[model samples]
Target: EDKVVQSPLSLVVHEGDTVTLNCSYEVTNFRSLLWYKQEKKAPTFLFMLTSSGIEKKSGRLSSILDKKELFSILNITATQTGDSAIYLCAVVPSGSARQLTFGSGTQLTVLP
Candidate 1:
Protein backbone atom coordinates (compact mmCIF):
# COMPACT_ATOMS: atom_id res chain seq x y z
CA GLU A 1 0.00 0.00 0.00
CA ASP A 2 1.04 3.59 -0.55
CA LYS A 3 1.01 5.77 2.51
CA VAL A 4 2.69 8.81 4.00
CA VAL A 5 3.06 9.91 7.60
CA GLN A 6 4.20 13.17 9.14
CA SER A 7 5.56 13.66 12.62
CA PRO A 8 5.01 16.49 15.09
CA LEU A 9 1.54 16.78 13.67
CA SER A 10 1.27 20.36 14.88
CA LEU A 11 3.63 23.09 15.93
CA VAL A 12 3.44 26.59 17.41
CA VAL A 13 6.18 29.10 17.01
CA HIS A 14 6.78 32.76 17.61
CA GLU A 15 7.99 34.98 14.83
CA GLY A 16 11.69 34.50 13.98
CA ASP A 17 12.13 31.03 15.36
CA THR A 18 13.04 28.01 13.24
CA VAL A 19 11.09 24.80 12.69
CA THR A 20 11.43 21.49 10.91
CA LEU A 21 8.73 19.27 9.48
CA ASN A 22 9.14 15.56 8.85
CA CYS A 23 7.51 13.21 6.39
CA SER A 24 7.98 9.48 5.83
CA TYR A 25 6.32 7.21 3.39
CA GLU A 26 5.87 3.67 2.10
CA VAL A 27 4.67 3.42 -1.46
CA THR A 28 4.54 0.57 -3.86
CA ASN A 29 5.55 2.81 -6.73
CA PHE A 30 7.07 5.90 -5.22
CA ARG A 31 8.48 8.08 -7.95
CA SER A 32 8.67 11.50 -6.37
CA LEU A 33 8.23 13.26 -3.06
CA LEU A 34 6.51 16.62 -3.02
CA TRP A 35 5.85 19.18 -0.33
CA TYR A 36 3.09 21.73 -0.22
CA LYS A 37 1.91 24.60 1.91
CA GLN A 38 -1.80 24.90 2.50
CA GLU A 39 -3.82 27.86 3.71
CA LYS A 40 -7.51 27.49 2.75
CA LYS A 41 -6.98 27.52 -1.01
CA ALA A 42 -5.23 24.92 -3.12
CA PRO A 43 -1.94 23.76 -1.70
CA THR A 44 1.11 25.53 -3.02
CA PHE A 45 4.14 23.54 -4.10
CA LEU A 46 7.09 23.88 -1.78
CA PHE A 47 9.56 21.21 -2.86
CA MET A 48 9.94 18.07 -4.89
CA LEU A 49 12.72 15.63 -4.06
CA THR A 50 13.83 12.74 -6.24
CA SER A 51 17.39 12.36 -5.08
CA SER A 52 19.02 11.75 -1.72
CA GLY A 53 20.86 14.34 0.42
CA ILE A 54 20.23 17.06 -2.14
CA GLU A 55 18.16 19.80 -0.57
CA LYS A 56 15.83 22.24 -2.26
CA LYS A 57 15.52 25.70 -0.73
CA SER A 58 13.56 28.85 -1.31
CA GLY A 59 13.61 31.98 0.79
CA ARG A 60 13.12 30.70 4.35
CA LEU A 61 12.09 27.14 3.54
CA SER A 62 14.24 24.18 2.55
CA SER A 63 13.80 20.45 2.12
CA ILE A 64 15.94 17.34 1.78
CA LEU A 65 15.22 13.95 0.32
CA ASP A 66 16.29 10.48 1.47
CA LYS A 67 15.23 7.74 -0.88
CA LYS A 68 16.88 4.94 1.07
CA GLU A 69 15.19 5.93 4.29
CA LEU A 70 11.97 6.83 2.48
CA PHE A 71 11.71 10.08 4.37
CA SER A 72 12.01 13.82 3.84
CA ILE A 73 12.46 16.86 6.02
CA LEU A 74 11.50 20.48 5.58
CA ASN A 75 13.09 23.30 7.50
CA ILE A 76 12.04 26.88 7.98
CA THR A 77 14.30 29.53 9.43
CA ALA A 78 13.44 33.04 10.57
CA THR A 79 9.82 32.15 10.53
CA GLN A 80 7.25 34.90 10.34
CA THR A 81 3.63 34.98 11.48
CA GLY A 82 2.66 34.91 7.85
CA ASP A 83 4.37 31.54 7.58
CA SER A 84 1.66 29.85 9.60
CA ALA A 85 0.18 27.20 7.40
CA ILE A 86 -0.27 23.46 7.00
CA TYR A 87 2.67 21.67 5.47
CA LEU A 88 1.69 18.71 3.32
CA CYS A 89 3.53 15.74 1.83
CA ALA A 90 2.41 13.78 -1.16
CA VAL A 91 3.78 10.88 -3.17
CA VAL A 92 3.85 10.80 -6.95
CA PRO A 93 3.63 7.48 -8.67
CA SER A 94 5.49 6.42 -11.78
CA GLY A 95 4.13 6.13 -15.28
CA SER A 96 0.44 5.75 -14.62
CA ALA A 97 -1.60 7.57 -12.01
CA ARG A 98 -1.09 11.25 -12.57
CA GLN A 99 -2.61 12.18 -9.22
CA LEU A 100 -0.79 12.78 -5.99
CA THR A 101 -1.70 10.83 -2.91
CA PHE A 102 -1.38 13.20 0.05
CA GLY A 103 -0.39 12.71 3.62
CA SER A 104 -2.10 14.28 6.58
CA GLY A 105 -0.19 17.53 7.01
CA THR A 106 1.57 19.20 9.89
CA GLN A 107 -0.15 22.32 11.11
CA LEU A 108 2.26 25.15 11.86
CA THR A 109 0.97 28.15 13.74
CA VAL A 110 3.22 31.15 14.06
CA LEU A 111 2.42 33.81 16.61
CA PRO A 112 3.04 37.45 16.03
Candidate 2:
Protein backbone atom coordinates (compact mmCIF):
# COMPACT_ATOMS: atom_id res chain seq x y z
CA GLU A 1 0.00 0.00 0.00
CA ASP A 2 1.21 3.51 -0.76
CA LYS A 3 1.70 5.63 2.34
CA VAL A 4 2.11 9.38 2.78
CA VAL A 5 3.20 11.27 5.88
CA GLN A 6 3.07 14.99 6.55
CA SER A 7 5.18 16.85 9.09
CA PRO A 8 4.09 19.21 11.88
CA LEU A 9 0.54 17.90 11.55
CA SER A 10 -0.72 21.37 12.44
CA LEU A 11 0.49 24.94 12.50
CA VAL A 12 -0.53 28.33 13.89
CA VAL A 13 0.60 31.71 12.63
CA HIS A 14 -0.49 35.29 12.22
CA GLU A 15 -1.30 36.90 8.92
CA GLY A 16 1.63 37.68 6.60
CA ASP A 17 3.76 34.84 7.97
CA THR A 18 5.46 32.46 5.63
CA VAL A 19 5.05 28.73 6.20
CA THR A 20 6.37 25.54 4.73
CA LEU A 21 4.65 22.16 4.85
CA ASN A 22 6.37 18.85 4.17
CA CYS A 23 5.17 15.54 2.80
CA SER A 24 6.89 12.18 2.23
CA TYR A 25 5.53 9.14 0.51
CA GLU A 26 6.36 5.53 -0.22
CA VAL A 27 4.74 3.92 -3.21
CA THR A 28 5.36 1.70 -6.17
CA ASN A 29 5.77 3.24 -9.60
CA PHE A 30 5.24 6.73 -8.29
CA ARG A 31 3.59 8.95 -10.85
CA SER A 32 3.01 12.32 -9.22
CA LEU A 33 2.42 14.24 -6.03
CA LEU A 34 -0.55 16.58 -5.78
CA TRP A 35 -1.27 19.32 -3.27
CA TYR A 36 -4.72 20.55 -2.26
CA LYS A 37 -6.10 23.16 0.07
CA GLN A 38 -9.30 22.49 2.01
CA GLU A 39 -11.24 25.11 3.83
CA LYS A 40 -14.80 23.96 4.47
CA LYS A 41 -15.92 21.06 2.34
CA ALA A 42 -14.15 20.15 -0.85
CA PRO A 43 -10.44 20.48 -1.37
CA THR A 44 -9.18 22.66 -4.19
CA PHE A 45 -6.23 21.48 -6.23
CA LEU A 46 -3.07 23.50 -5.69
CA PHE A 47 -0.28 21.89 -7.64
CA MET A 48 0.71 18.63 -9.25
CA LEU A 49 4.36 17.68 -9.26
CA THR A 50 5.52 15.01 -11.67
CA SER A 51 9.15 15.96 -12.05
CA SER A 52 11.92 16.88 -9.67
CA GLY A 53 13.56 20.30 -9.26
CA ILE A 54 10.61 22.05 -10.84
CA GLU A 55 8.72 24.49 -8.65
CA LYS A 56 5.05 25.21 -9.26
CA LYS A 57 3.61 28.42 -7.96
CA SER A 58 0.34 30.37 -7.81
CA GLY A 59 0.05 33.72 -6.13
CA ARG A 60 1.67 33.28 -2.71
CA LEU A 61 1.78 29.50 -2.79
CA SER A 62 4.52 27.36 -4.30
CA SER A 63 5.50 23.70 -4.22
CA ILE A 64 8.48 21.60 -5.22
CA LEU A 65 9.14 17.92 -5.44
CA ASP A 66 12.28 16.02 -4.49
CA LYS A 67 11.89 12.63 -6.17
CA LYS A 68 15.29 11.52 -4.94
CA GLU A 69 14.07 11.96 -1.37
CA LEU A 70 10.52 10.75 -2.00
CA PHE A 71 9.22 13.97 -0.55
CA SER A 72 7.67 17.34 -1.42
CA ILE A 73 7.36 20.74 0.18
CA LEU A 74 4.65 23.42 -0.06
CA ASN A 75 5.60 27.00 0.73
CA ILE A 76 3.15 29.81 1.34
CA THR A 77 4.53 33.33 1.43
CA ALA A 78 2.91 36.24 3.19
CA THR A 79 -0.06 34.20 4.12
CA GLN A 80 -3.40 35.79 4.93
CA THR A 81 -6.11 34.69 7.33
CA GLY A 82 -8.02 33.38 4.36
CA ASP A 83 -5.16 31.00 3.69
CA SER A 84 -5.96 29.05 6.82
CA ALA A 85 -6.93 25.58 5.78
CA ILE A 86 -5.96 21.94 5.76
CA TYR A 87 -3.26 21.21 3.22
CA LEU A 88 -3.47 17.77 1.74
CA CYS A 89 -0.79 15.82 -0.09
CA ALA A 90 -1.78 12.94 -2.30
CA VAL A 91 0.45 10.50 -4.16
CA VAL A 92 -0.51 8.99 -7.47
CA PRO A 93 1.03 5.74 -8.62
CA SER A 94 1.27 4.58 -12.19
CA GLY A 95 -1.35 1.86 -12.45
CA SER A 96 -4.49 1.06 -14.32
CA ALA A 97 -6.55 1.67 -11.17
CA ARG A 98 -5.76 5.39 -11.14
CA GLN A 99 -6.24 5.95 -7.42
CA LEU A 100 -4.82 8.60 -5.15
CA THR A 101 -3.20 7.86 -1.78
CA PHE A 102 -3.62 10.78 0.54
CA GLY A 103 -1.72 12.01 3.58
CA SER A 104 -3.43 12.88 6.86
CA GLY A 105 -2.99 16.55 5.94
CA THR A 106 -1.53 19.57 7.74
CA GLN A 107 -3.91 22.02 9.36
CA LEU A 108 -2.75 25.62 9.17
CA THR A 109 -4.36 28.43 11.10
CA VAL A 110 -3.64 32.00 10.15
CA LEU A 111 -4.87 34.58 12.60
CA PRO A 112 -5.54 38.19 11.91
Candidate 3:
Protein backbone atom coordinates (compact mmCIF):
# COMPACT_ATOMS: atom_id res chain seq x y z
CA GLU A 1 0.00 0.00 0.00
CA ASP A 2 1.12 3.56 -0.73
CA LYS A 3 1.82 5.72 2.31
CA VAL A 4 2.51 9.39 2.93
CA VAL A 5 3.64 10.92 6.22
CA GLN A 6 3.81 14.56 7.27
CA SER A 7 5.72 15.83 10.26
CA PRO A 8 4.74 18.27 13.00
CA LEU A 9 1.08 17.48 12.75
CA SER A 10 0.37 20.88 14.29
CA LEU A 11 2.41 24.05 14.57
CA VAL A 12 1.98 27.52 16.02
CA VAL A 13 3.93 30.52 14.84
CA HIS A 14 3.77 34.28 15.02
CA GLU A 15 3.10 36.44 12.04
CA GLY A 16 6.20 37.07 9.94
CA ASP A 17 7.71 33.78 11.02
CA THR A 18 8.94 31.25 8.53
CA VAL A 19 7.81 27.63 8.47
CA THR A 20 8.76 24.46 6.70
CA LEU A 21 6.35 21.57 6.26
CA ASN A 22 7.50 18.07 5.45
CA CYS A 23 6.05 15.21 3.48
CA SER A 24 7.51 11.76 2.85
CA TYR A 25 6.13 8.85 0.96
CA GLU A 26 6.72 5.21 0.03
CA VAL A 27 4.95 4.01 -3.05
CA THR A 28 5.40 2.12 -6.27
CA ASN A 29 5.72 3.98 -9.54
CA PHE A 30 5.65 7.50 -8.18
CA ARG A 31 4.58 10.17 -10.60
CA SER A 32 4.41 13.52 -8.87
CA LEU A 33 4.04 15.34 -5.56
CA LEU A 34 1.35 17.91 -4.90
CA TRP A 35 0.65 20.47 -2.17
CA TYR A 36 -2.58 22.15 -1.16
CA LYS A 37 -3.78 24.71 1.34
CA GLN A 38 -7.14 24.18 2.97
CA GLU A 39 -9.06 26.94 4.68
CA LYS A 40 -12.66 26.75 5.86
CA LYS A 41 -13.69 25.53 2.45
CA ALA A 42 -12.09 23.14 -0.02
CA PRO A 43 -8.40 22.84 -0.58
CA THR A 44 -6.67 25.09 -3.06
CA PHE A 45 -3.95 23.66 -5.23
CA LEU A 46 -0.55 25.08 -4.49
CA PHE A 47 2.01 23.15 -6.51
CA MET A 48 2.81 20.02 -8.41
CA LEU A 49 6.43 18.96 -8.39
CA THR A 50 7.69 16.19 -10.63
CA SER A 51 11.39 16.81 -10.81
CA SER A 52 13.85 16.39 -8.03
CA GLY A 53 15.86 19.34 -6.60
CA ILE A 54 13.83 21.86 -8.64
CA GLU A 55 11.82 24.22 -6.47
CA LYS A 56 8.52 25.81 -7.35
CA LYS A 57 7.49 29.09 -5.76
CA SER A 58 4.66 31.59 -5.67
CA GLY A 59 4.65 34.65 -3.49
CA ARG A 60 5.74 33.66 0.02
CA LEU A 61 5.23 29.97 -0.58
CA SER A 62 7.67 27.53 -2.15
CA SER A 63 7.99 23.78 -2.47
CA ILE A 64 10.50 21.21 -3.64
CA LEU A 65 10.47 17.55 -4.43
CA ASP A 66 13.16 14.95 -3.74
CA LYS A 67 12.26 11.92 -5.74
CA LYS A 68 15.44 10.11 -4.81
CA GLU A 69 14.69 10.38 -1.11
CA LEU A 70 10.96 9.95 -1.53
CA PHE A 71 10.13 13.20 0.21
CA SER A 72 9.12 16.82 -0.32
CA ILE A 73 9.10 20.05 1.65
CA LEU A 74 6.93 23.17 1.64
CA ASN A 75 8.27 26.46 2.87
CA ILE A 76 6.43 29.63 3.79
CA THR A 77 8.39 32.78 4.41
CA ALA A 78 7.16 35.91 6.15
CA THR A 79 4.04 34.14 7.16
CA GLN A 80 0.88 36.02 8.02
CA THR A 81 -2.30 35.13 9.87
CA GLY A 82 -3.87 34.67 6.48
CA ASP A 83 -1.44 31.82 5.89
CA SER A 84 -2.86 29.85 8.80
CA ALA A 85 -4.47 26.76 7.44
CA ILE A 86 -4.17 23.03 6.98
CA TYR A 87 -1.49 22.18 4.47
CA LEU A 88 -2.01 18.94 2.62
CA CYS A 89 0.48 16.70 0.81
CA ALA A 90 -0.56 14.27 -1.83
CA VAL A 91 1.29 11.89 -4.12
CA VAL A 92 0.27 10.52 -7.47
CA PRO A 93 1.36 7.08 -8.50
CA SER A 94 2.16 6.30 -12.10
CA GLY A 95 0.07 3.64 -13.78
CA SER A 96 -2.98 3.18 -15.87
CA ALA A 97 -5.17 4.12 -12.89
CA ARG A 98 -3.57 7.12 -11.28
CA GLN A 99 -4.89 8.21 -7.89
CA LEU A 100 -3.91 10.61 -5.16
CA THR A 101 -2.70 9.29 -1.83
CA PHE A 102 -2.81 11.99 0.82
CA GLY A 103 -1.10 12.50 4.12
CA SER A 104 -2.77 13.51 7.38
CA GLY A 105 -1.69 17.14 6.74
CA THR A 106 -0.03 19.79 8.87
CA GLN A 107 -2.13 22.28 10.76
CA LEU A 108 -0.33 25.63 10.83
CA THR A 109 -1.59 28.53 12.92
CA VAL A 110 0.00 31.88 12.39
CA LEU A 111 -0.84 34.09 15.35
CA PRO A 112 -1.11 37.81 14.95
Candidate 4:
Protein backbone atom coordinates (compact mmCIF):
# COMPACT_ATOMS: atom_id res chain seq x y z
CA GLU A 1 0.00 0.00 0.00
CA ASP A 2 1.11 3.57 -0.71
CA LYS A 3 1.70 5.62 2.40
CA VAL A 4 2.71 9.17 3.29
CA VAL A 5 3.86 10.53 6.64
CA GLN A 6 4.21 14.17 7.60
CA SER A 7 6.13 15.34 10.60
CA PRO A 8 5.28 18.00 13.14
CA LEU A 9 1.57 17.50 12.68
CA SER A 10 1.03 20.96 14.14
CA LEU A 11 3.16 24.01 14.71
CA VAL A 12 2.95 27.52 16.14
CA VAL A 13 5.15 30.33 14.98
CA HIS A 14 5.44 34.07 15.34
CA GLU A 15 5.18 36.40 12.39
CA GLY A 16 8.36 36.58 10.31
CA ASP A 17 9.50 33.22 11.60
CA THR A 18 10.70 30.61 9.17
CA VAL A 19 9.40 27.06 9.20
CA THR A 20 10.17 23.78 7.51
CA LEU A 21 7.55 21.11 6.88
CA ASN A 22 8.42 17.53 6.00
CA CYS A 23 6.75 14.80 4.01
CA SER A 24 7.98 11.25 3.49
CA TYR A 25 6.41 8.56 1.40
CA GLU A 26 6.65 4.92 0.43
CA VAL A 27 4.78 3.94 -2.66
CA THR A 28 4.78 1.18 -5.26
CA ASN A 29 5.18 3.50 -8.21
CA PHE A 30 6.04 7.11 -7.59
CA ARG A 31 5.03 9.74 -10.09
CA SER A 32 4.92 13.07 -8.32
CA LEU A 33 4.30 14.76 -5.01
CA LEU A 34 1.99 17.73 -4.58
CA TRP A 35 1.75 20.43 -1.93
CA TYR A 36 -1.36 22.38 -0.97
CA LYS A 37 -2.30 25.10 1.47
CA GLN A 38 -5.79 25.22 2.94
CA GLU A 39 -7.04 28.32 4.70
CA LYS A 40 -10.82 28.62 4.77
CA LYS A 41 -12.46 26.61 2.03
CA ALA A 42 -10.75 24.87 -0.84
CA PRO A 43 -7.10 23.93 -0.80
CA THR A 44 -4.86 25.92 -3.10
CA PHE A 45 -2.04 24.35 -5.05
CA LEU A 46 1.41 25.22 -3.82
CA PHE A 47 3.83 23.01 -5.69
CA MET A 48 4.36 19.78 -7.55
CA LEU A 49 7.65 17.85 -7.47
CA THR A 50 8.56 15.33 -10.13
CA SER A 51 12.32 15.70 -10.28
CA SER A 52 14.81 15.30 -7.51
CA GLY A 53 17.15 17.93 -6.08
CA ILE A 54 15.31 20.77 -7.83
CA GLU A 55 13.68 23.34 -5.62
CA LYS A 56 10.39 25.02 -6.45
CA LYS A 57 9.70 28.42 -4.96
CA SER A 58 7.00 31.03 -4.78
CA GLY A 59 7.41 34.23 -2.79
CA ARG A 60 8.20 33.19 0.80
CA LEU A 61 7.62 29.50 0.13
CA SER A 62 9.78 26.80 -1.42
CA SER A 63 9.80 23.02 -1.73
CA ILE A 64 12.21 20.36 -2.87
CA LEU A 65 12.03 16.69 -3.66
CA ASP A 66 14.65 14.10 -2.76
CA LYS A 67 13.83 10.98 -4.71
CA LYS A 68 16.79 9.05 -3.40
CA GLU A 69 15.73 9.73 0.16
CA LEU A 70 12.03 9.21 -0.47
CA PHE A 71 11.13 12.51 1.13
CA SER A 72 10.35 16.17 0.46
CA ILE A 73 10.55 19.38 2.42
CA LEU A 74 8.56 22.60 2.25
CA ASN A 75 10.05 25.80 3.58
CA ILE A 76 8.32 29.03 4.41
CA THR A 77 10.26 32.18 5.12
CA ALA A 78 9.06 35.42 6.62
CA THR A 79 5.80 33.90 7.65
CA GLN A 80 2.82 36.08 8.42
CA THR A 81 -0.53 35.60 10.17
CA GLY A 82 -2.05 35.03 6.77
CA ASP A 83 0.33 32.15 6.21
CA SER A 84 -1.37 30.13 8.91
CA ALA A 85 -3.09 27.19 7.32
CA ILE A 86 -3.16 23.43 6.90
CA TYR A 87 -0.35 22.26 4.64
CA LEU A 88 -1.18 19.08 2.80
CA CYS A 89 1.22 16.63 1.15
CA ALA A 90 0.04 14.09 -1.34
CA VAL A 91 1.77 11.59 -3.60
CA VAL A 92 0.53 10.60 -7.02
CA PRO A 93 1.30 7.07 -7.98
CA SER A 94 2.16 6.05 -11.51
CA GLY A 95 -0.15 3.87 -13.60
CA SER A 96 -3.76 3.94 -14.67
CA ALA A 97 -5.23 4.14 -11.19
CA ARG A 98 -3.64 7.54 -10.59
CA GLN A 99 -4.95 7.69 -7.07
CA LEU A 100 -3.34 10.16 -4.70
CA THR A 101 -2.17 9.10 -1.27
CA PHE A 102 -2.32 11.94 1.23
CA GLY A 103 -0.92 12.61 4.66
CA SER A 104 -2.87 13.96 7.58
CA GLY A 105 -1.33 17.41 6.92
CA THR A 106 0.43 19.87 9.19
CA GLN A 107 -1.51 22.70 10.76
CA LEU A 108 0.57 25.87 11.00
CA THR A 109 -0.50 28.82 13.13
CA VAL A 110 1.33 32.10 12.83
CA LEU A 111 0.89 34.68 15.59
CA PRO A 112 1.35 38.32 14.88
**Predicted structure 2: lDDT:** 0.96
Poorly placed runs, candidate 2 (over 4 Å): none
CA deviation > 4 Å runs, candidate 1: none
TM-score list, all predictions? 0.96, 0.98, 0.98, 0.98
Angstrom error of the Cα, residue 99, model 3: value is 2.0
lDDT of each: 0.93, 0.96, 0.96, 0.96
| Per-residue alpha-carbon lDDT of candidate 4 for residues 1-110, written as tens digits (9 for 90 to 100) | 99999988999999999999999999999999999999987999999999999999999999999999999999999999999999999999898976789999999999
lDDT of 3 by residue, 21-97 (tens): 99999988899999999999799999999999999999999999998889999999999999999999999989886
Please give, for residues 2-78, the per-residue lDDT of candidate 2 as tens digits. Answer: 89999879999999999999999999889999999999989999999999999999999999999999999999999
The ten-residue window of minimal lDDT in model 2 covers 92-101
Error of 1 at 74 (Å): 0.5
Better structure of 1 and 3 per TM-score: 3
